[model samples]
Target: MISAASRAMLAALALAAATVTAWAQDFPNRPLTIVLPYPPGASTEQVARMVQPILQERLKQPVVIENKPGGNGSIGTMFVARSPADGYTILLTTNALMTIVPHVQAMPFDPLKDFVPLTTAIRGILGLAVNPNVPAKNMAEFIAYAKANPKKVHYGTAGIGSPQHMAGLLLNREAGIDLVHVPYKGGAPAANDAMGGHIQAVIATISSTLGQHSAGRLRIIGIGEKERFAGQPDIQAIAETVPGFEATSWLAFYAPAGTPKAVVDVLNRELVFALSSPDVKKKLFDLGLPAVADKPEELDKRTREDHKLWGDIARQMNVRAE
Candidate 1:
């Protein structure tokens, strides 16, 4: 026999679920906005633009791309974090915001708790490029050269605590070489200094160094991926020289915490479909970003793991944000 209190509890639960289902069915009755925590024309923005049309078409609503970049992505990220949990405002950010930034500075919201991971949209492979004058063609040669000239060779990156900086730090630790790290305001300046001989090497994206490498102005030492990226197979993976070496950046989507499960499912299914389209894949590949669509649970697990991994690396290296 069902007691009165037990039946009432069951009825309440059922009513709440039905309400959420109805909300999901009515989602995006208005325009949806994707807040990016980086400036316009960035890799994140480009990837968002590529997927916007697909999302708009599938959702039958205008999808807005808003740039809210600052504080190494914390400013805009926090904005999205505090937004209403209506599934109308989404966060499109890089792994840096979730994994790298928190280790260096205080954030207004908890990365692990303030949002729900939707999916990983794209992955970017970092590459090590050296000026032609440096006596190295691959990771082995580069490591040997740095070893021979301890404290003499310097490498530039976007900034301290940036992914490129972490890649440089990891390389130094794993290769047991001493390469003085020189921080720049952005990757462009770092690449410029490398070309002008101010720095011997630069750890930046493959796209940033590809043109110079092809022109023989810069020699790519190695790529920071376990295997050569399919988009550019000529470059060898750094792991070939240093076993298990891998450092790649990625972008993902998220919804503010407390969003209904039904709304999340609808958004995930449609966006994953958008990311997996052939045309979208080609466009991303052309821009040096590979389209990657993983399940929500998969993205959630990866985010948590990277949060710890980068945090440990930062502490072990004594790296701090500037």
Candidate 2:
């Protein structure tokens, strides 16, 4: 009872489905590559290396890592986005490149449409820390001090449009204070400046400055999570004082768009299994990046939500990268 054209269209769809299924079934016949958008020795690269053996063992393929660092991770990210959807070349990068960078700069690739998220591998919480010279003991006193000082109080971050920078901007809006932003080449330098009293405050990963905080070199006033980090429960969350401030950073895996669902599922399964391993979990935790795993759809949802959230924050703060 169907027209000839309709019958032909159905036949085409069925053929395409079969083709994709066969392609997925034959995936990773050779070596697989994981591209990192940053230089070697970064946390992202470390994580990729940690899971490389597991992936190689499970898939029976050599997992090669390529570092194509430049343009704030866009160079490498774009490389993965343009790769064939054969699941051979993958991307491992931080949430900032996907969720925040696009909002602040002109990117070569579309974050939402160009790639399929495999899963989030690990996450870390950012915190606001101040030099011991700052007359602030906690979030409340810090807010009060900033209100009194205005432009006189300065905060340093890794760079403009970085997660730490965004957190500082959010704090400005949420707490109604002006904390001047000083951009540095990296978080470690920023934290070092804060400790040297060259800057009054710094928004950095809690672990990067935790030792300093414990030694009285820097004082961590508030973390950028809704709740205190389980690893450091003694520190209060910024949200506890600012009501809705949060800035969590994470690393995730992705494949080029149009990748078959079956192939994506296979990668996700291996990733989840590797991340759930006890040794992997302990290593990630020791590095201050707690391992996490989720379904592809969950990662997609989180990516979309974070994309929108960061866009809103960037627009509200009038933040644009140069």
Candidate 3:
């Protein structure tokens, strides 16, 4: 028994409140899919699975990891980009695919416009290594051999146009060495080939190769970081030999464009929190994959930076799909 005006006003307020709550709760009503452009066993996949549970715990939804690798990482990216803007499908990718791919080819979608960048999850540093049996024991010796042999040494990559490929290409151009480019279906295979001596050398991420480097199956001819890997500071950085050389492979998460800002913020906060957790950080650190979280704006900046940087390197090296 209320007046019509009072009842109407109460209903309007309740609807408004419900709409906002619905907007917040409206997201993630179903199983969310996070797409990985790389195949299984990739550091991107490894770290994504590491944090997947944390996100699920926070959101109360099961996160399904989908590996859609191929087309130089375009297939998975395009799939996520074209998905509904309801924040269900996410793209977990590396710098090479998200930023460097467009520079190398005309992709079906614009990375910046088609996807809402979620955040940078982790960054694994790159290292240039060679099999123990190769004539080159160190970076200088390796360069000497390459210079003398010229195109005889096969350089392995995660795949054509991948960051590992770009790293090798950049090193070749900078050092004026001609190493045969060999692209594998994924980084693990490329690393395995390099470790098995099937290929002469590989520029692989620290996370994938550090174990062998420690085990002595592979020798680090040169590393591509400003500083040496911890406990191996005497090993020397590639920049030490060539000067101005540093390349790191990174993993990032993204969502379809037009997703509600509220949902994006919620995920970002949870992701950063999960990454900073001692357990998560320790696990990744032991795996040689360091946790790196960048704000959406910072990740965007890095994307632009890497696109320009890798594009220049690719153009200079004349790197192309092979």
Candidate 4:
């Protein structure tokens, strides 16, 4: 039953499969690039630099970091989305790009559909801090103060529709306070303004606020985790006072959709290995970001969960992207 034409077709199919397997096995013939959606000094960039060396070592190839910050991280993210799905160009960014921004602004790419989740590297522990001049020692006091002096209780965030901003939005809803949002170009500016008392409060990662809090220029009121952040044990969780109030940002990696499964596996394995190093873990802890290198499936699950959670909040609060 084997005609000449059928034999040719079978031979071609077998050769194609063999070619794909060989290609996968011979991946990364050149340098790999990790695209950062925010400018340098942003949390994602910090973590990427931390792991870059480890990745280069594991892959035996140069690992480059490219920053393309804009449109609330959408610009760089979309750039990666449109890149070749050959696994050379990867995306190192925060969950906000996929989880929160889409809910507020129109996007050029569908985050949920355009990228393949690689892994989440770290969880940035956020905290609520107030200027020393504010008459608030804790979340309750701050909420009460904000209620009484709504106009004076403005809070600074990394930018409009950022994770910091979303946390502030959630706090406003749960604590029944009206803290005005003052968006800045980045966390550094926001923290600086908060330290100078130009802004009354700031809800940013503990690392961003730790120096000011330690110098007594800013008073850390509460953390934004279910439990106290490890780096700042004295500060209480915002949930302690405003029950069910918890929000945090995380850094994760992604590759363009249709990237071969074999390539994804290599990246994920190396990433998990890099983050599992003791030195890397300690560095992350010192920076107030806990290492959380979970499986790619877990990142996908969390992305979906957070996307829905923040989407609901965005709709309720009528948040619009600037």
Best model number under lDDT: 2
Q: What TM-score do all the candidates reach, one by one?
A: 0.97, 0.95, 0.86, 0.93
**Per-residue accuracy of model 1 over 37-116 as CA lDDT, tens digit each:** 98887788888888899999999999999999887788899998999999999999988888887898787878899999
Candidate 2: residue pairs that collide: none
Clashes of each: 0, 0, 0, 0
Ranking by TM-score: 1, 2, 4, 3
Candidates 2 and 3, the one with greater TM-score: 2
CA-lDDT, candidates in order: 0.89, 0.90, 0.81, 0.89
lDDT of candidate 2 over 147-196, digit per residue (tens): 99989999999898888888888889888999999999888899999999
Clashing residue pairs, candidate 1?
none
Cα misplacement distance, residue 303 of candidate 4 (Å)? 0.9
lDDT of each residue in 126-243, candidate 4, tens digit only: 8888889898898888888988997668899888788899999898888887889999877888888988888888888888888889999889899889998767789999999989
| Stretches of model 3 off by over 4 angstroms after superposition | 1-22, 25-29, 231-234
* Model 3 lDDT per residue over 1-322, tens place: 8999999999999997788668866666778888888778777788888888988997788989999988778889899988988778888888887767777777888877887777888877788889899998778888899999987899887777788788787788777889898988777777788889899888888777878888988887777777776645667788777888777788888889987777787777878888888899988877767788768877888887887898887787666664
Of 1 and 3, the candidate ranking higher by TM-score: 1
Residue 43, candidate 2: alpha-carbon lDDT: 79
The runs of at least 3 residues in candidate 1 whose Cα sits more than 4 Å from the true structure, single-residue gaps closed, are none
Tell me how far the alpha carbon of residue 231 in candidate 3 is from the true structure, in angstroms, after superposition.
6.4
